[model samples]
Structure formats: structure tokens, C-alpha cells
Target: MTPGRPDPARRRWRRIAVVTAVVLALAGANGPWLYRFGSEKYHAYRIDRPEYKARNGRWEIVEFPEGYRQNTIHAALLRTGKVLLVAGSGNDQENFDARRFDTRVWDPVKGTVKKVPTPSDLFCTGHTQLADGNLLIAGGTQRYEKLKGDVTKAGGLMVVHNENPDKPMTIEAGTRFTGRKNGKTFVAQDAVLVPRARKRFDPETGRFLGNDAGLSRVYVEAERRGARHETGAEDNYRVQGLRGADARNTYGIAQKLALDKKDFQGIRDAYEFDPVAERYVKVDPMKEARWYPTLTTLSDGKVLSVSGLDEVGQLVPGKNEVYDPATRSWEYTGKERQFPTYPALFLTQSGKVFYSGSNAGYGPADKGRDPGVWDVRTNEFTKVPGMSDPDRLETSGTVLLPPAQDEKYLVIGGGGVGESRASTRRTRLVDLRAKNPRFTDGPSLGRGTRYPQSSILPDDTVLVSGGSEDYRGRSGSDILEARLYDPDRNSFRRVADPLVGRNYHAGSLLLPDGRVMFFGSDPLFADPANSRPGVFEQRIEVYTPPYLYRGGRPVVEGGPGTLRRGGTAVFRSPDAARLETARLIRPSASTHVTDVDQRSIALGLERTAGGVEVTVPKNRNLVQPGWYMLFLTDRDGVPSTARWVRVP
Candidate 1:
């Protein structure tokens, strides 16, 4: 061939290049096949990625129990490496009622959940785990007029244990009051245990009988020290309590993983708790209260506080703060994209923070692309791979799952892509570790709502829990469904029908043992007179996976018992009866599982025979309410039969 003549192979290669480029361009511009949703794939995930999503999501729903309570989920989940822990305020309370505290632990391998015990009310959004294995519970007052008829309750924090993972927990509130058992203790309110001090006021000799402000002698004091006062399994390292604030900024967070722990160690920056002195020393102050702000502790040992309302609900204008544990001073970062308010600040193992979702600025009205990430290395708010879902509003949750066996940072359900208030049932899988890492829309929440949180298990399963089935004033506000997201399968399956319908909830992962623990919510809280349809669920349940079921395949719809300290909970299967019932168990090891039939059981920190624990579920939703055995009938008539349910 002549030197200038194009070789047949060369000509072929050139044609291939043009065709490949054209195909990709079209795919980017239109939907998958240019049919169904002519909208481009980029339009769907909000990020540019055609390669990763083509695979399957490992997350999938395997098990769903019935007769479970439907309630609101509003607490945060704590992970210790193996187990998953979740807690929240029940729907019974109104407007941040800290009085009703409930917690549960999930064992992923065994697929079982246990309820720990708490003494007084363990408020919602006031629970955290310390490095020493103790839990730091926030203390405060609970103002629920329905539960007690206008008599507002007081609040306090209790330190509980978690090492045993199955034992009951002992708790210590600031003052010595008659516990529910003793009969003279004040209920605690929303509590947060930060490295700080707690103070109270006491009149010279003020007693309840006189008009002494109805308060006793109180003064300034430290909540926790090197560990805690009167150490033990519960609160041994957990102090009395830190002040818990109202959940603002659309997405509520207190910056759980901050690198300042070491700084709070020997250094004792200007405004931190002095480990040696066991007191609150004057350290530098943050630029703001960081109300509901998400935080990250960079590997370099600095704290980044971003996006929350400052006392008022206005997105802190261009608000982003950074704290130096060494200096104990807060500095102003730059303006973040308007993403946080109701967003989740997720940090990967690599020390990067992913700020996703928030309706902070626009409650259920504004139509805008919420902000995404605040990169520390670049010290700027960068765009996330696929965050902007115009349809999903109030994307308040962003959890970082462990690296899949193949290695990926799996980012799941955030807000909705529909109207601002709706939980668009949209979830995405992200692999930030990849060179061209992007997000892929995994599965729709299917009847999903808003304010839900997700947790990852050892096998790499993501469990999604609680959110309002409807918006604030809209119908179906309380959602009663929970699902598992299998990243490998690239899909979602409803695991259990909630005994209780809940919204604005949180989830945590416990270590050593893995289980998905879900807390319930009640809608009668704020306004008892007006019953918002599908408003509350007052029970809790644990979805035991077959892997965790030592008894082998459980008979579908077989009777089971509620496990707690103080008593042994047992049940007689109603499989033969008309229906099954959910046994609401509390933290007491006494096994006082009263044969009660309802949606869910609101919970708080309670004492177990061995260590600390929360209230848990017996059977799950989809069953009926009554004192009977739990056995699967597989009757075509059972509600939501399409949902996954196991039979013995």
C-alpha cells in the first residue's frame, strides 16, 4: 500500500472512535433507551456516570417481620465495628420531647436485635457512644402534654454500658431521684454528652414545698472527666450529660466524628473539659453554636463544623466553621452550597467529608439543587459525584458504609427528587475511592418518605429506617416501612413493615455484633387532640437474619418472645389463631413483656441485669395486634404480602 493510503485497519479504528463517542453522548443526553424517561441518566443521578450504575447494588431486603409498631425515628446510630445501635424519640411526644428515649441493637450475622434498659427517660437525639465503651446520653426536660396531661417533665443524662452487647445497662442521672422502681425521679430531656460541664442553681434551703423556683440547690459542675465519676460498665467513661439542643438545620447532627478527641486529651484547648482537673476549662469558642451542624475531624487534627441554623432557622449565611483542638479556637471557613440544613455530613475512611442533602433554606417550597461536599484538602465546597436530585428534597441523610469486599464508599438514600417534602424513594451507590468515582441510582424507597437514616452491616448491607410517610401538614406523614439496600444487587427490598410509623429519625451501627435496630415514632405528641392520620407507632422490632438464626430456618409466623433484663419474655405462637401480636419489651431484665398489642413501644435508657440496653421488639409489623404466638401463615390476605417475610 502507498505510504499516504489509509490502511484498512486504521480506517476501521477511526470509525470505531466516532461511533463510540456518539453512543456515549446520546446516552448522556437521553434516558437509558431514549424511551421511558427521555431524561438523560445524568438527569437522574445528578452526576455524570454511565459505567458504574450498569452494575447491580449489593443491598437487598431479605427479611421483614409483622405486627411491629409504626413510629418516628429521630435518633442517631452508633457503630463500634461489629454491631449496629439505633435510638429515637417516639411519636407520642411533641416538638422535641426528650422524655421518651428508646434504643435497640442489631446483629447482622445473626439478624437479631436486643433492647437495652434505661432508668429515666432517655431523650431523643441525645445519645452517643464514648471511646471507653460507655454511652453519653444527653439530659433534659420532656414536654409532652398528651402523656402526662400538660405536666412537662424534666430531663437528665444517664451513662450506660455497651461492651457486653447483650447485657442490661445501668444508668446515672445527675441527681439522686427515685427511679421508676424507687418512685421519685425527674424525667430527663434531650441530652448530648460533649466534653463540657453541667451546672444547676440551688436556693439557700429551697425545697419543693416552698416557692423556691421549685428547684433545689444547684451549681456549676463537670459532666465527665478522664472517664466518669463512680465508673462502671455504664457511663464509666460516660459523663453525666451534655446539653442537647433542638433539631434544626433541616438535617440534625452534632459532628460525631471530630479529630479533636486527642486535643480534648492532655492538651485541654482553651474551651474544653480538663481531663486532669475534671472540669470545663475556658477554651476557644466556635464561631457559632453549630446547631444541627455536621462536623468532621481531619486527619491533621482539626474539626470542621458546617451548615446549621444559628439559633434562628436561617442557614448560617455562608456559614462554615473549623475548630483547632490544639488552639481550641473556631475560625470561619467559606460559604457552603445551600445543602446542609437537613443534610448528612458523611466522612469516608480516607478523612474526606461529604456534605449532602438539606432543605434548610426552603422547607417544602424552595426548588433548588442542595449543596454537596466541603473538601478539606481544597478547603472548598466541591460538587459531589451525583448529589443534585431536584426531585428529592430534604436529603438529610448521608451514611458511609464500610468498603464493600470490592472496596467502595456506598452512599445511599438522601432526600427526595420529587417535591421538597416527599421522600422520593431514591437511593444512590457511590464509590469515591475509584479514579472516576461517581454515584449510581440504586433503587427507589418504594412508598418511602423523608428523614430516614441508613446503616451498613459487615456483609455490606445498608439498612434504611424511619421517615415521615407524608410531609409536615400533608397526609401519610408518618411512614411505617424499613428496607435493606444491597449495594451488590443494586436494588432495595422492604424488610419489615414497621409496627410504628415514624419520621425524622436516626440509625447507628454497633461493632462486634451486627443487627439493624429501629426506633418508633408517635404523632400524637405535639397535638394530642388532633390525630394526624398515620402519625405514630409505639413499638420496636428486630429483624433477625437467617445467618443469625441459630435455630436454623424459623417457621414462618412462629411465636417468639421479647428479650429484656429483669424478666424472661415468652410467647405462644398464634399461627393457629386468627393473628399474631407484637411483644413490646423494655430495658428491664425482669422480662416484664406485658401481653400488649399495639404498633410500637417508645423507649429510653433502662437497666439490664448485666449492662445498659434499650427497649426492643418481639415480632414485627404486617402481623396483627394481640397476645398470641408468632407463626407465618403466608395467607394471601396479610397486608403487604409482597414484602419479604420469613417463615419457620
Candidate 2:
């Protein structure tokens, strides 16, 4: 050993010794609990521990990378069939430093991350992979710095220049605007990202204590950065991500709204891009101009852009505009959606748009409206069903997480931002299979907060990444906590946080490997140190299941394995929690799970108090032999736990 410290060889030995001790301790967390560990799906097996099995309830942040630019991820694509992945970043110019806008594409196999080139020197709001495999991104500048108001859209409210009331906070003057590097703009900004909350327990009293579930609050105040000047020019805008439902057509539509405030005449047009041809063509302009709307493609091949910043000057009520790609002209369709304001439009497998989560007024309710959903097919404007969760503001607040499936919408974390309730920090699980699909509040975050975006894997497990939480009566972001949900178990567990902070960003999907991709975004302006809203990004990230490294359990912990066609296994049920009853698991192992786009083989289950008993299906006689484990979990509805059995 060295005089003050151990030598490198000694340090290495010490690390090994520590790891061995940890492994031994984990093996004894409960007791020696072994059963056949094998599943037909992946042909794997292992042992089980109550503590470890419980860990599977949420994402396990096995590892994390360094903190990159000060931005949120907007788009991400895992390079399927390959080891690398690409992610796009969108930095908020008004609140973040511009430098964070740097783009970062990552290599999962090599464990290296780098940058990629964006098509334009502008902020990208949406991104997706084309059918042909190229990345498609769309966005416009906030009309700050080198970008002029004449050619760019204003981000904030200036009653005189206000075009959309739903989002009243308008971009001040672009003439005085500089890149987000100057650090001089936060002085008067008032616009804010929503907040979150958390739940805690008094250590001494052992009583539940509630708190905000978020990071520090950073308000955005609008200020004129340059002298006022106006020129007669044109402004163009980009729409949301890809819209065409069919893969063969590989076609998408984006809106380009040209507004010349000097002339008070607004121009609206749509552009069609052919991924196969690698080109873009302009479609006809609509009779009316709409902003902050959702464009959905129908099963009948019709494309509908619903409820936008209406030119008629009404904020709550909205008109639907239908575009016949073949016809090339936008037909003023019927008034399908009355309160179509900034709605999250998700396309269902049946070619219908699953609409949810929306802002009612151009501004907050006190200023006008709250949030809701409008169905276009039924011309429905009635109050949304199943989404009447209580909020602090009494507004309709729905935690719009990623889609659980083409048939189901996923709702993860959320705060009382739009609610009028005392319990502001909460998570939710919204099963969208009902006639009046709404939500069932999940376990409270023990605080009030909302995780805006979550990544849903093929297995139906959800990865809730970033969002805002309430902290110490102030505001904060949910960038620190993550959770996982297993329908079989119907429970949520605390997981590891991403290495860095991210909120109000999009989660992009990468196929084949089924890994998670995270793009970046920026919420602060002035000080490009963290981002470049209209410029660049420095990193991208991918989340792979630590299955191989986990050594056992497909996140089950204590132990798990693959099941064979003729193998039998056993499992012990876990105890109940606060009156929560448990579900029994049988034939614990799954032999044939689905592929990236398919389903997994279904096995049978039995119940036990310490755990569960597992068995294989009779048809397994024709199946191949392999290792597998049974999994059990409980959904609060029936208070039953889902159990997994191994067949190794």
C-alpha cells in the first residue's frame, strides 16, 4: 500500500471484495428461495427475493451518463438491429442558455455519445423516423435574436400582435432579442413550466409528511431585448410529428402559417412530404388558419387537423379542417370539436385519433379555460368522461403520459397544476378501454407533481422520465425520480433518475431492441451554456434493460429464470400492503412472449400467501424446452398481485 492510499492493485482487490459482499448480502435479503427459473419467451431463469421481486414495480436506474446541455429531449430513435441510437434536442430559448441546443446522437454498443447535424438553425418541436429510416424534424424559432419577428412567429403575448389567445404569453420584440447566452432576459419572465409535489414521512414521529415534488422554480419573464422594428416579410411554422398512419404511403403533413401582422392578413398552407422520394410538396392552403391544433389521419384515409388557434378570434370553440391528400385542397369540414385547444392527439390502431389532455382557454382558466378532450368523429364537444380528476385550480387535469398501447393511453406522474385539490403530487394509471375512458388515480407521489412524458415499452411496462414537481412549497421538476408499472402487479415503485434533468420533452421510440431513447430540451433562455434552442445539442441517450447485467430476474430481483415446455416451478406470495390484497401466480414461467411488435406466450398462475404457485399450459406438450420464471403482481382494483413462476 502507498503511504497515504492503497495501490491500484489493492484498490481493485478492495472493489472486488466489496462487490462480493453485496452479492452475498443480497442473496440473504430474505432467505434461500429457489424454484425452477426459466421462461419460454427468452429462455432465462434465476432465484427470487421478496425485496428484489418488489423492485420490479418500477424502473431500476442501473446506470446513467453525464449531464449534458441544459435542455429537455424532444425526439429519440434507437438504431434497431444495431447498437447505436439517435436523439434530437429542443432547447427553450426564452428560459435556457442557447448552447444546450447542441444535438447529441449516442452509440449504445460502444457506450459513446456525440453530436449530429440539424437541417436548420432553428428549434425543433417534433421529430420522428420516416418509413424509409431517415429522421424527420419540424419547428420554428421563438422569433428571438438573429431571427426576426417578420419571418418568425412570436412566442409570447403582445395584445396588439396577439394572434392566438389560448397561449396569451406572447414573444416580446425580436429586434431586442439575442441568443439565450446573454443571461439578461430572466429578469422579467413570468411564463412558467408547471410544478410537482412529493410525499414524505416525519423521521422522528413516523408520520406521513407531504411536500412539493419538484426542483427549483425558474419563472420566465418577457422583456424587450432589442429596439422595436418591423419589416414586411413572411413567417413559416412547422407542425407536429408524422401523421400518415399507413407505412406504405410513408407520407406526412405539416402546416406552414405565414402571418404578416403589418398587413393583418394571415396565410395558412400545408406541406406534404414523401419519405420514399425524399422530397416535400406543398398542398393547398386552408380557407381558415389554425394554430395549436392536432392533425389526425382517419381510417378512411382522411386527414383532420382539429381545434387550433382559430382566426375567428374565439378561444374555447374550435372548427375541424379536413385535408384530402389526393384532392390537395383543405376542405372546411364540420364543427367536430368545439373545445379543441392544444389537445394531445394519438392515433389508434383503428385509424381513429385517441384525443386527451388539452388547455381550455388561450390562457389559464382564470384568464379563460382549463383542459379537456374533443372527439372529431362523433362531432363531440361534451365534457370528457373519466378525466374529471380533482386539481388544485379546479381545472380538468389529466397526466398525459405516453401511450400504453395503440389501444390504451398511459398516464404516469402529475401534479395539481390545473387541479383545485390539496393533494397536488400524484401518479396515475389511465386504462383507455372504457366507453367513457378517463383515469384512475394511482399511488400518490406522496406529494403533488406531474410527469408529463413517459416511455412505454412493448411489454406494457411504463418508464416515467421527467416532469415538474412541487418542492418545499415552491416549484420543481420531476427529473430526479422514475417509476415503473406492471399491469400484472398493478403497482408502482420508485426507480433511479436519469443522470441529468429533463422535463416537458418528447420520448421517441426505437424499434427491434425495444430500448428507450431520450432526446433533450431547454426551459431557460440566455446563456447558451446548456442549449441552443435554434442551434445545436451536445448529447443523446438510450435506456436498455439491465437484464444481462442484472444477472437474474427480468427486473424481478431476488431471482428469475426461463421455463421449459415440461418443467414445473413454485413461488411464494408476498404479504398485503395497507389493505391491498394480492393476486396469485401459477405456472410461473412464460414460454413464448411476443417480439418487438408482437405478444408473449401466456402461462397460467396459482395463489399462495408467501408468494405464488406456477404451472404450464397443457399445450406446452408441443412447445420446446427452456428455462423460465413466473411473475406475480397486484392491481389495486381487485387488490390482487400478479405472480410469475419459473420453469427451469
Candidate 3:
């Protein structure tokens, strides 16, 4: 004891204290790193807790093997319970040039991914689930956009006129048009078919009035890559390789073809991706080429395609068309209705289309920007009122709230038109069943958001998650928060935050297993300073809602493969007595924060001795003809794995 200065034990204790103090000092110097590591460990422990997950839900990241990863731009939940991930060129100009289009069929249950052959660059394409259970994908990127400084050639749209009443004319790709006034030659980038001119007659006199020239537009560029080759005024151009009356009948006119920025062009290509066959079948092309179009399934099961940049990179001027799955053909709607690119148009139970005014860039801001009910049959529109932050509808997410029979829609956060810094967290709710349906302010998000991904859960709650505080998630503004929106209470409950940030080109779709799968995020910059170009997020994330963590879930087994709209179908389930509600949720076809195909329809549930019987709605428009995921939820809102059912 008296040996404190000499004892070996005292000396060793002194050395231990010194080492502990040194370690503490070093840890203090690197506190942030140490704290972060501890916090992450705590988070991992907290989320793994059964009680925590039962309340707040859980998120898991699904990183595909390096060879299978892709910049998925669009996703669709097929009837076969597999997800179709499409990333044609994936916003990469190099891939587009290399003809490296990609599509993947991912089985979430089996955890397998298989690549499918992509025929065209389906980037920015419009897609919807068809009545035949095939996915109707139409229109896509024909050319990438070129910025002003990047454009080396003088180019603009050239309108070729056909004045001959006898026959149509074909202007092949690379066809030259020499200006008669300026003596400059320009080349067409693609083929154009100019129809025969229409000969008009007087209704009363029965006399020939005049021949109206038929016009077709094609994009043309100067032969030389110099400013001197640009045109400053409108000029008539003579069609090369044409002779006699044909030469005079077919001519070109272009206004001010200069070295300016060229917008992205679209193609008329369309296809039906058959989930059963796991292949794409070519269909009749669309009547008008489209980029960033919206395809809404009508009550009759025909998909209406509207609003996009055309072949010449100009707004398609309200010429909406429809695709008939039965005939595998598209036809003009015979009605003109203008909308911005990717406008949110939902078909209502009244057999009319409702435009939510939510759009994804392109077109003049002032025109076709009002939320309204559009009668496609009569070309009539009745504007709905009271949309908050109306100017910031761009990139907003619209969800037809659960039990779609109520016709209530929730429009989530959005930003201002095209690259504007403005954003809004305000959510707007509208009930079409009201005498005068108008949007009213609902619960707000925690922060300003854009490109929010909202998916309808089978339990009647909408999961609204992920967005950016800025345009295209510029300056590293991607928002990572998520919430469950309860339409029943008209409130939002904070959920577990997502592991990844998602913004432009991102989407979420509910899986058959009651989980939500999120894919794609294309940020504009990699850092807050916007110094480095951003990389696309290809890692898919699956969110398991809180309900999934509950002890046991009900089950839907052995249901009829087909159910009539007004008929009842019995499903075998041991937990039928515990089942509270049944929902027929339409599979999702999601892209660019737009998913009109995902709707949850409430079914009348009746518990039997050993199973449950569900009756479908009598209204065909209310329950659109399609393949749906039938889920039964118990008292705790825990849903069963979906049973595939077809509404015939």
C-alpha cells in the first residue's frame, strides 16, 4: 500500500489512465464521424425493433447486381405480379447513340431480374394498363435535345405542302430542300408522309370552292454547320428529285431556320408488352408522335393519349388520340383538347376525363393550365376551382384516393413551371361527388416538394413520399421523407424515412405483396454547390408499411380468375372472420410522378363459414375493366398478399 510510487500495480493503473485520456482526446477531435457511426448503429437497432417497425414501418434497399443495374425511368406492375422496369436509353445520350435500350422484368417475390429486348428508345413514353392485361406503351424519344451552345447546325421545322388532289407524297429521310429565295439546301432528318389535298365544296351551291393543301411537318437542318448557312426570313423551298406537276405540287416552307436550341423529338412507335409472354409485340403506331404524353384509360377500356412534343419538337396542338386494344390500332379522338406535357388526366365515373392541371414541363404556361372536367365526347371543359399554389403544379403527384368510388383526389407537393426555384408543400383535395367539385387545401407536407411519389395502398392509405425542394433535385435538394396519408381521417402520419433520395424520373408503385417499390432518381447536380453533374440512382427501394410487421395477415386464396362487374366472387381464407375490408386495387403503370392506372376500389365484403365473398361494383366506369390485385385487410389495417382478379 505504501508502494504507490514503486508498486507494479499502481504503475500499470497510471499507464492505463493515460492511454484512456489520449483515446478520449482523439475521439473528441473526430466527434462527428464517431457520432455518425453511433447514430447509424442506433438507427439500425431502432428500426429493427418489432415495436418500432410495427408503428413506423421499415424500408429496405434493393441493389441489383452490377450487370443488372439500370437507370429505370418507368415501371409497371404486371398482372403476373412481376414489375416491368423500362429505361430506354435512360436519359443518356451515349446509350441512345449506341442503341442500348433496356427493359427488365423483375420478380419481387422470387428476387430475380431478367432483361427484355427493347425495340425503341421508350424514354419519356406514355403507358397504361390495357383491358387485355397487356401494357400499352406508346411514343418515345426519337432524338435527344440539344442545348443552344451545343447545337452546331442551323435547324428548324419545315412544313411540306401537298397541293395534288390525286395522291400523297413521301419525303424520305435525307431529302434535300433547296430554298428558292436564299439558295441554301437543308436536309430532312426523318421521312414525312404528306396526304393528298382536300377538295372543298359549297354546301348549298354544290360547287367546287378550292383545294386546301395538305401539310406535314419535318425537322430539317442546314447542309453546313455554320451561322452563315442560317436563314433569317421565311422562304419557299423546291423539293429536290421531283419533276413535272409533282415538283410544283410538293414544296417546303420554313421560317427562320437558325442555329438555336433544338428540343427533343418524338416517334409514333407503339407496343404492347405482354407480361405472360415476357415480350413486346409491335402494334400500329400512334397517329401523332409524342414525347411526354399521358395515356388515360377510358371507361370503354380504350386508352386516350394526349399532350406531347411532336415529331418536329413542337407541341402537338391538342390533337388527342385513343388506342383500341382489340384492334391494336390508334385513332384520332375527333376532338381537340390542349394540355401541357404529362398532364394528369383521370377518367371519371361519369364517363368524362378530369384534368388535375398537374403537368411535367413543356408548353406555354398560360394555356391549358387550369384544372377541369373535360368531356371528351363533346370537347367541353368545366374548370374546377380553389387549387392552392396553382402555378406550382408542375411535378406534383395526384392520387385518386382509395375507394375510388368516392371520386376524391389528393394532389401532393409540386414546384413551379420549368426550373423555377418555387415549390409548395400544400396538398389539395377534391371530391367530384360534390355538387360543384373544387379543390380544397388539405394537410401540408413538412417542406416544399417536387416530383413526389404517391402510391395507393390496399389498406386505403396513400403513401406519399420522396421529392425535391428544387427543380430536378438541383443543388442536392432531394427530399428523403415519407408519410402515410389517411383519406379516412384526412390526415398524414409520419413514417420511416426512405434510405434514398428520389426526385425527377422517380416513381413508386404498390406491390402485390403489400409493399411499395420505389425506383429511379435523376438529380441535376451531385453537390449543394451544383459543381458536379449528378449520376442517376438505379437502386430500387422497397418500403414495407407498418401494417406488414403485425403478427399475422389475412389471406385471399383460390378466387375466381374472372369476375363480372356486378358479380360476387368467393375466396377461400381461414381468417375470413377477422377480415374487415376488401379492396380491388388496379395495378400501377407509373412514370414521371404520374400513375393514373393505380386506383383502389372498395368491394362489398361478406364473411362466410370458411371464406369471404366480395361483390364488385355495378358501375363499369367506377371499376374499370382490368386486372386488379384483390386484398383483404383485417381490423388492424394489415392486408393480405393480393390475389389476382380480372374485372370483365
Error of 2 at 255 (Å): 27
Per-residue CA lDDT of model 1 for 1-648, tens digit only, reads 888899999999999999999988988887456765545454445322323222221122323244222232433222222222323244344423444444444344565644543333322212222222222222212232222232123222232212221222222224232222222223222222222122234556543332111111111112322222211111212112322221110111111111111100001112332222222244464554333344444444455554443322233454566665556567876544444333444443355555544432222345224444455556665565565354564534554443221334434333443334455566665666567666667667665455564554433455666666444324545555666666657767665344444444333222222234444443423442334444443344444332232222212222233333222323232232322222221110000000011111222223333322333333222111212111221122121011111111
User: TM-score, each model?
Assistant: 0.43, 0.46, 0.98
lDDT by residue (1-648, candidate 2, tens digit) is: 558977899789999999999988976773434222224222221213333433432222313255433333333332222212222224343432443334444444555544444333223222222222333232222222323355333222211121221222222222222222222221212222222334568999989765433321111222433322221223221111313331111111111112322111112445443323333345575544443343444444455655544322233245567766557677766654443344445444433444444332232443313323335566544334454343332211233222222244433433343322233454445555557656565655554443334544434455555544432112333345556655556666665445444433333333333455554433332233423322322344555433212332221223234444434444443432212221111111000000011112334454444444444443321121221112333332222212232232
Taking every candidate in turn, the Cα RMSD to the unseen true structure, in Å, is: 24.9, 20.6, 1.7
Worst 10 residues of 1 by lDDT: 588-597
How does each model score on lDDT? Answer: 0.36, 0.36, 0.94
lDDT of 3 by residue, 443-537 (tens): 98988999999999988999999999999889888888999999989999998999999999999999999999999999999989999999999
Considering only N, C-alpha and C atoms within 3 Å, which residue pairs clash in candidate 3?
A: none
Better-scoring candidate (TM-score), 1 or 2: 2
Q: Model 3, which residues run further than 4 Å from truth? A: 1-10
At residue 608, candidate 1 shows an lDDT of: 32
Off by over 4 Å in 1: 1-285, 323-338, 358-371, 385-388, 404-421, 466-468, 472-474, 477-479, 494-496, 506-512, 520-540, 550-648
Local distance difference test, candidate 3: 0.94
